[model samples]
Target: MSKKILVILSEWGFWGEELVGPLEVLQSRNYKPVLCTPTGRRPRALPPSMDPGYKDPPLGKTVATPEMAEKVRRLDDPSNPYLANQRSLKAMLPERPYWSDLGELGYPDERGQMKMSYYPLRKWEGYCRARAQAQQALVEEFEALLLVGGSGPMIDLVNNYRVHDAILAFKQADKPIAAECYGVACLAKARNFDDPRSIIWGKHVTGHPQEYDYRDLAGVLDPETGAMLSREAGNPDRWVNFGPPFYTLEHILRDATGPEGGVHGSVGRPHSVIVDYPLITGRSTADSYTTGEKLVEVLEKGLRRYGW
Candidate 1:
């Protein structure tokens, strides 16, 4: 049977190449991709991603070539049929929570079980985690889950319990989980509440490096509501600090993987892609194609663990 992959995209805005690069490889190999969103709505590409000449403020270079830009534009076209179709996260939910959701139950007592006391704030975490985990069985429907990245991810994908649940399920099933650029931040945040350590706590990975991050205005849109995604919509500021200038995916991955795990980055090199079994990551937009290629190798060639 042709390989089918579940691709998670942010409703806000995804970097065009981040989606196109890996997708191009997957398409060439005839791998079927099922696009999904947090709310099951169609996702859109960030405006800047379509501009081949768009200069990255920090890198001081054009991030996308004209050829790649055209490809991204085609992929993002509403009439393309791919972006036009999507599945809802709610439809995937099952009954039980994953092992991580237990942490949110009540802070987990000394024995690593839910504490007797109640944690109102944590209740939602527990609920979301459980719902996400129950959907772990959904891994059977696809070979892997690909998290595409862009500034929009910072607004929705990060700390999203459903996304975490899906990642955990993929890990439990030993299916490859691929992510790129800011999308890598989900790994750092996908931790078992009781464990104080991230799922990548001891795994080598690569992500958006500190040097790769830059300050820019990123607008997040709620595909369901057709409005700017904001926390304090009633207030004038309305969570204006959602996307800051200094946040870097590499820093979080480095700390999450702990001192034992390695976070490789291209300081002087042109590209970076790391495959550490079940977790395939890429540095930035430059590594998107390589990231997809690496994922293909892991899924098709029985490759496991590379890219120190």
Candidate 2:
């Protein structure tokens, strides 16, 4: 039977090659992709991703080629079926139940003193029911989940609990989860409330390194919602100077993996893709296609672990 994969993108902006590179491999392998966003808005590739002339400051060279740039534009175009057909995470996933909504087992007393206890009844029960239903549906429907990367993830994905829940659900199902660049940060932040340690706490992974990070970041501004993407919307003709990445991916991944695990970046190698079972990761744009291929192998060839 053909498999279906959930391909998530940042509504603000995604890097051109990150999505296009891996997506092509999946499609070629007869894997159906269901493109989705945090809120269903059409995700676009960053302006720099669409410009072949845009030089990567950190890399100190031209990154976007004309052919790749064109592909990104076409995929992001609303007229195209890919961007036109997408799902909203908000509508698909269930929200977490509030701690204060424990019914008879909760709520403070009139004296202003706190009075609360833990119980699995009332509203909490109903919430758990709905949450179970949603998580089950996702796990049964998709074979795996892929989070495409870019600067936009810093704003829309890193702290998104909806995304966190999805990651947790997939992990519980023992399914592979593939992420690239900044998207790998999502794995670092997706953790259980009780444990707190990231799921990748003891797994080898790859992510955008501190050295690859840009000293001066630029992002696109959404005209409608005024959300920042990958560039300045006002200054379309030129790049605008803005704050760099919110945090370094290498640092976050290193800390998330702790002393036991490791983070392999492109310190000496040109590309880095690490597969520690159900957790496949790519260092940056250069590793996109390889990450996708490794994911396919994990599914079809019984490949368990790769790259420490």
Per-model C-alpha lDDT, please? 0.78, 0.82
Q: Which TM-score value belongs to model 2?
A: 0.87
Alpha-carbon lDDT of model 1: 0.78
Candidate 2 clash pair list: 219-230, 219-231, 220-230, 220-231
- Over 4 Å off in model 2, which ranges? 100-123, 221-232, 235-242
lDDT by residue (1-308, candidate 1, tens digit) is 77888888888788889999888899899998888888877898876787988888778888889998888888877678888788876567532345434343343333335543245545555455445546556787889989998877787788787788788888888899999988888988986556688899889988877776666554565565434455545535554445444376777888899988999987778988888888999988888989999999998898787777
Q: Candidate 2, residues 1-308: lDDT per residue as tens digits? A: 66999988887788989998888999999999899889988787887887899899988878888999899878767677768588999988866656665444432334434445465444455455565677889999999999999888887888898898889889999999999999999999998777979999988998988888887764644624534433334545444455678787889999999999999985868889999989999988878899999999998997888887
What would the TM-scores of all predictions be? 0.81, 0.87
Q: Which candidate is the best by lDDT?
A: 2
